[model samples]
Target: MSLSAASRPELDDTLAIRRRTLTLGLLTLTYFFSYMDRQILAILVELIKADLKLSDTQMGMLGGLAFALFYAILGIPVARLADRANRRNIIAVSLALWSVMTALCGLAQNFVQLLLARIGVGVGEAGSSPPSHSIIADLYPVEKRASAMAIYSLGVVLGGGFGTMIGGWLASQYGWRVAIIAIGVPGILLAVLVRLFVVEPKRGLSDAARVADSSRMPSIWSAFADMWRNAAARHLVLAVTLTSMIGYATSYWGPSYLQRSLGFSVGQVALIVAPIAAIIGTVSGVGGGRVADWAAKRWGIHAQSWMVGLLKCAALPFTILFFTTDVPAVAITAYVFNMLFANSYLGPTFAMLQGLAPLRTRAMWAAITLLVINLVGLGLGPTMIGVLSDALTPLVGKEESLRWALVVAVSATPWAIFHYWRAGVMLKRQQEMAA
Candidate 1:
C-alpha cells in the first residue's frame, strides 16, 4: 500500500540516495565500455587505413561524422523513451546491442564494413548518456550533482586510456581485429550486471517534496517546450555545441597529428600519448566536479559560470602552445592541460541542465541538448577538419595543413565562454524560481 504523504518524504529520500549511488556506479561502468569501444578505432587507425587503402579524410568520416550522424539523429527519440519507460532496461539493452556491433568491427574487410559497424556502435552509445543523466539528476540534490557527474565522467578518461593501452598492445601483438574483439566482449557481461542490480529511483527524489505537488509526469512535448522556453538552456546548449566542436575536432585529429608530424608509430604514440591524456583527463574531470560542487555551495549557483570561465581562460593559451611549440615535452604538456580544461565542462554543465529542466522532462531535455551537441559538434567537427586538411594539403602540404587546421579549430573556445556566462545568470533565475 502507498504510504501517507507526510511519511513518504523520509522513506523516499533514504531509498532514493541508495538507489542513486548503485545506479550511478552501474552507469559509470557502462560508460567505461561504451567509450572503450568508441576509442579503439583511433588506436587502430593505422592498420585500418593501410588495410582499407583509405585516406585520412575517409578515416575521419568513419571515426566522426558517419557514426555521429546516426547517433545524433536517434538520441532524442531514445531519450524520450527513457523519460517515458524504464531507463534501467533501456541501458541494459543498449549495452548488449553496442557490444555485439563492436565485435562486428573486428570482421570488417573493407571501409564500408567498418563504417557500418561504427554506425551500429554509435546507435548503441546514443542510448546511454541521456537516460543515465536523468537518473543521476533524480538521485542527487543540485548541490551534490556536479561531483557525482564528475565521478561518472571519469569513465571517459579511464576508458580512453585502457582502450589505447590495451588496444595498442593487442594491435601490436595479434592485430587490430583482435583488439576490437577484446574491447567489445566485456560490455555484454556488464549489461547483465546492470540489469540485475540497478533499481530506478523515483523522479526528483532529492528535491524538496514541494515539487511533487505539481504533476508527477509531464508529456514529452510539454517538457521539450519548457526547455525551449528557458533562455539559459538555449544559450548553454549553444556554448556547449561550439566548444564541443573544437574539442571533438581536436580529439579526433590529435593522434593523427602526432603520427604525421612526429613520425610516431601506432604502438609508440599509443603508449606515449594515451597514458598522459587519460591520467590527466581523469584527474581533471574528477577535480573539476569537486571544484564545481564546492563553488556552488560556497559561492552559490553561479559556480558553473566560474568553473567555465576558468576553463576558457586556461584553454586559450595552452591550445596555442600545443601547435606552435616544437618541443615534444612542451607540446604534450600543453595538450594535457588542454584536455584537462576541455573536459571540465562535462559534469557541471550536465548537472546544471538537469536542475533547469522540470522533473518529468529531464531525460527528454537532456536528449535534445545532446542531439544538438552531437549533430553540430560530433557530426561536423572532425569532418570539417578533415576537409580543411585535404584542401590545404595542396597549398601548404599535409603537415602544415593539419597544424593550421587545428589552430583554426581551437579558436572556438571564446564563443563557448560567452554562452557559459549567460547560462550562469539563467541558472540563478531558475534557482530562485525553485526556491
Candidate 2:
C-alpha cells in the first residue's frame, strides 16, 4: 500500500501524500490487472484459432473489434457517470465485471460465444480507464503529471509482460481455456481491495482550484466540442489514434509472427517478449514521461509533443527492420529498439491529453480520447492487419502475409509523427496568442 514506489512526498500535498500515493499505486495495480486480463488472449491466439477453426480475421475481431467497439462506445457514458459518481466504486465494479467476463472467455465453445465474451470484457473495461485518469489528475499537478502518469503506464508494460508469459506457460501445460480461467479469478479479490482502500480525491484538488458544481456540469456534446475546438487536443486525437493502430496490430500479431516466421515457440515468445517488454518497455514508458516532463520544464509544455513525436519517428525504422528480417536474432533485436521508442509516447501523450481538459470534464475528455484510441486503434488495428494478411495470402502464402501486413501497419507511423510535430507547433502558437 506504500506508494513510495510511485511518488515523493514533497511533490504532493504533505498532509495527505501517503494516502494519495497509495491510491495511485492501487490504481496503477488495477490498470496492471486490466491489461493482463485483456492481453492474455494474444498468447492463446493459435490455440483458439485451431480449436474454433477460425480465420485470422475472426481472431482479429475477437482481439480487437469485438472488445474495442463496446469498450470505446460505452466509456463515454461510464465516464459521464464517473464525473458525478464515486470513481473508486466505478473502477471496482468494472474490474469485477471484466474479470468475470474474462473467465467466461475460457468457457466459450464456439466463435460466437467467444466473441460475445470478449465484448462483455470490453464493456466492463470501458468503465475503468476514464475514471482512473480523472482520479490521477486530481492527485497530481500539471508539473508532476507526466511522471505520475508514466509510473502508471508502467502497469500496462508489466501487466502485459506477465500476462503473455503466464498465459503462454499455462496454455502449454494445460489448455488455453484453463489458462484464461486461472488468470481471471484473482482480479475479483483485487476488486474487493480496491473498493475498500481507494479513496476518491476531490475534483481539482491537485490544482488547488474550485470543483465545478454537478448541477451545472457541461453536456457531453459540450465536452466533445471543447476537445475538438482545442487545437492541441485535436492533434493529440489524430496522433494517438494512428500510433495505437499500429501498436495494437503488432502486439496482437507478434506471437503468430514469431511462431510462424521466426521459429519461436509459444513458451519461447513468452520468455523473450516478457523480459523485453517488462524491462525495455518500462524504460520507454517511464522514460517518455520523464523526458516529457524535463522537456516541458526546460523548454515549454509544447516541447513534450516534439519529444514524443521524435521518439515515435525513431521507432519506424526498427519496426520495418523487425518485420522484414528473416533472421530471428535480427528480428528480435530490432523488436527491442522498436518497443523502446514505440512505447515512449503513452505516458507523455496521456498526461498532455489530461492537461488539455477542463477540471469538470476531465473524465469526459479521457473517455473521448480513449474512444478514438480504441475505436480506430484497438478496433481496427488488429482487424485491419488480419484482413490485409488474408488479402495477401494468395500472393505471399499464409505465414509470410502476416509479416507484410504488420509492416504496412507500422509504416503509417510517419503520418502520426507529422501530427505530433504539428500539435507542438499549434500548441506553441496557441500559447503565444493567449499570452
Candidate 3:
C-alpha cells in the first residue's frame, strides 16, 4: 500500500489507511446515488403506467432499453477518457449530470419526454463506473481486490434498497413524480463532496508487477478485441453477461410481479423486497469476496472461478421456486436463498476481471464489460420479459404472464454456469503453464 502511494511520502501508513477508507467511502456513496437514481423508477412502474395510461412494454422500454442504450454505448468513450484524464472530475461531472436528469424524470408528462430524460441519466451514468472501478483497483492489490470491490458494490444493494423503499413510500404518500425528484436531486450534493474530498490515486499502484503502459491511448475496439482474445476473459464476460441478464430482468420486474400477481400494493411490495433483499445481498456480496479471496490463496485462482460457477448452479432451485410459487412464505423463503447465491457472484467476478485486465486497459475493459452486459442484460432482459408477457397474456392470462416471464428469465442460469466453469478450466491451464 505504501509503495503505491509512495508519491505522498509525508503521509504515514495510518494516514494512508484513513485516506483509502475515505476514498472508498466517498466512491461508495457516489455509486449508491447512481443506483438510487436509476432504480427509483422500478418502484414507480405501476403508478407511472396507470397515470400515463401506458402498457407494460412501454414501461419496460422506460426502465430498461432506453436508459441502457445510452448508458452502455457511451461508456466506452467516457471510460477511454477516464483511462487518461482526471478520473475524479469525470465522476463528479457524471454524477451531477445524471442527478439533474433524474430530477427531470419527475417533470415528464408523456412517454417521449420521460424516455429522453432517462436517456440523459444513462449518458451521465456511463462515466461513473469504469473510472470508479479503475480507482478501486489502483488502491487495493489483487489479493485484497474482491473485498474492496465488494465494499464498492454495497452501493448497488444499499442504493437499490433505499431507492425502492423510499421511492415507494414517497410515491404512496405524495406521488411517483415527487419520489423521483426527491431521490434524484441529492446526488448533486454528493458530487460536490466527491470533487472536494476524493484524491485521485496513481494508476496501477496496487499491482505487484510493474505493467508497462503506453504513451498513446488505444482505441476502444483495439482494447476490447485484445481482452476478448484472452480465453479466460472471454468466458468470464459471457458468464457475467448471462448473469446480468437474469439480474436486471428480475430487479426491474420483481416489484411489478409482487404487486400484479400476489395482490400486494406497490408500497407493500417495496417494503417487503427492499430491506430483506438489501440485507441478504449485502452480507452475501461481502462474504463472497472474502470467500473468493481465501479460495484463490488456498487453492488457486481457478478454484475461485469454480466457486462462482458452483454457486450459480446452487441457486437454480431457489430461482425456480421464487418465480413459480405464489405462497408468500414459500416464495419469499425461496427468494432469500436465491439471493444468497446469486449476489455472491458480483465481487469474485469483478476481482477476476480486474486481475485479467491489463493496466493501461483497465477502464476500457471495465467499460466493455458494462457495454456488453448492459446492452444485452439491461437493454434486452426486461424488454424480453415485457414482450414475452404480452405474448403469454392469452395463455397465462395478463396478470400471471409476468410471473411466467420471470420464470423464463431465470432459465438462462445453466448457460451462465457453463461459461464460468469454462473460465475455471482456462485458468487451470494457465496455472499449469506457470508451474
Candidate 4:
C-alpha cells in the first residue's frame, strides 16, 4: 500500500500571514480573558476571606485544588477532542462555559458553593490552551512559532494584570461580587466573536512536504507512554511543573502579602504593584519569545531549553531577596526582577514542547504536560504555601509567617533550574541523534 502524493503534507500557504496575525490576535484576546477569569480570584482573596470567615488553608484550596482538580483531569479528554474535532468550536464553547462559571462565582453564598464555581471555571479553561497551541503550530512554521506563541502568551500577563486591577477596583468600589461578574461576562461575547471570525487550519499545513502520514490519531495511553520513554520530555515536564508551582504560588499570594506585610492597601496593590509586575511580565514574555526564536536560528532546537534554564537560574537570587526583604521599595524592586525572569520561559518552553511532540499527538502532549503542571503547580502550590503559612503563624505571627512561606515557594526554583538544565542537555543529544 503506497501512500498517495495527495496524502503527503504540502505547505498550505493558503492562510496569509495577515490572517495568521489576526488569528493570533483573536486567540490571544481569548487567552487573555480565560486567564483573567481564572485569576481574578487572587485579587479578591482578602475580600472573600473576610466575608466567608475562611482560613488561608481554605483559601488555598479554592485557589489550587478545587479549581485545578477538575481542570487537570478534564484537560486530557478535552485535548483529545481538540485533536480530532473542530478546535475553534472547542475553544468557543470553553470560553462561554468558563465565563458563565466565573459570573456564577459572584453568586456563591458559602465556601463550598464558591469552590464548586471555581471548579467549573477550571473545567471550562481546560478546553482553551491545547487547541490554541495546536492552531498556533498550524499557523506558523518552527522558526516563527515561539514569537507567535509568545504573543499569545501575553494573555497571561494582560489577564493577570487586568484581573487584579479590575477585580480589585470593582471590589473596592462595588464589592468582590461585582468585580467577578464584571470580568466574567465579557468573555461570552468574545466566544461569539471566536466562533464567527476564527477559521480552522488543516493539520500539518505549515510543516514541510513529505511528512509521514499518521492517518489515525494516537490513544491517550500512547501519548503518556511516549512522554515516559523520552528523557527530554520527562525532564521538560518536571521543569515546567516546578516553575509553575513557584509562579502560581507567588501570583496567588502576592496581593495579600503586600497588603498585610508591606502595609499596602488593596488599591495600592492593584494600582502600583500589579501594574509594575504586569509591565515586567509583558516585556519579558514577548522578549523571551523573540530571543528564543533568535537563539534557535543561531544555535539549534536545544537553544530554547538553555534560554529557559539560564533565565530560571538568574531569577532565583531575586526571588529569595524579594521574600526576605522588609523595605518596601527594595522588596518591590526585587519582585520586579523576579517577575522579569520568572515568565520568560513560557514562550520558549511551550515552543519546545510543540516542536518535540509528534504532530498527531501535539495537542494531547500539551494536555498531558499541562495536567502535570496544573496538578503540581496550581493543585499544590497555593495549598502548600497556605498550609506552611498557617503552621508558622503561631511562632512567627501572620506577616512573618507569610513571608517565610513565600520563601519556601521560592526555594523550589533551584530544583526547577536543574531540570531545565537536564532537559536542555537531553534536547541537544536528541537533536544530535536526529541530525
Cα-based lDDT for every prediction = 0.83, 0.89, 0.88, 0.88
Residue-wise lDDT of candidate 2 within 174-221, one digit each (tens)? Answer: 989999999898999989999988877778878865555566889999
Badly placed stretches (over 4 Å) of model 4 are 1-13, 16-18, 209-212
| 337: Cα error in model 1, Å | 2.3
TM-score of each: 0.93, 0.95, 0.96, 0.96
Query: Could you tell me which 10 consecutive residues in candidate 4 have the lowest summed lDDT?
Result: 8-17
Candidate 2 local distance difference test against the native = 0.89
Off by over 4 Å in 3: 1-18
After best superposition, candidate 4 residue 150: deviation in angstroms? 1.4
Q: Which stretches of candidate 1 lie over 4 Å from their true place?
A: 1-16, 209-221, 429-435
Across 1-435, the per-residue lDDT of candidate 1 in tens digits comes to: 466877876776677676777778899989889878877877777688788898878887877898788887788889888987889899999999999999999999988898999999999988998899988888888889999988888887888888888888889899989999999998999999999888777777777752633545666667667877888888778888898788778877777777777666778767888898888988888889999999999877666865776788887898889877767788888888887787788788888888777777788888888888888888888888888888889998977788788888888788889889888887787778878
Clashing residue pairs for model 3: none
Cα lDDT for residue 270, candidate 2: 85
* Model 2 ranges off by over 4 Å: 1-16, 209-215
lDDT of 4 by residue, 1-435 (tens): 345555433333454344788889889999999889978988888899999999999999999889889999999999999989899899999999999999999999999999989999999999999999998987889999999888899998889998998889889999999999999999999999999888788776677752635688888999999988999889889999999998889889988888778888888888888898779999999999999999989988788888898988878888888778788999899988888887888778888888878888788988999999999999999989889999999999987888889988888788998998899899999889978
Give me the overall lDDT of model 1. Answer: 0.83
**The 10-residue segment with the lowest total lDDT in model 3:** 8-17
Backbone clashes, each candidate: 0, 0, 0, 0
Which candidate, 1 or 4, would have the higher TM-score against the true structure?
4
Query: Of the candidates numbered 2 and 4, which has the greater TM-score value?
Result: 4
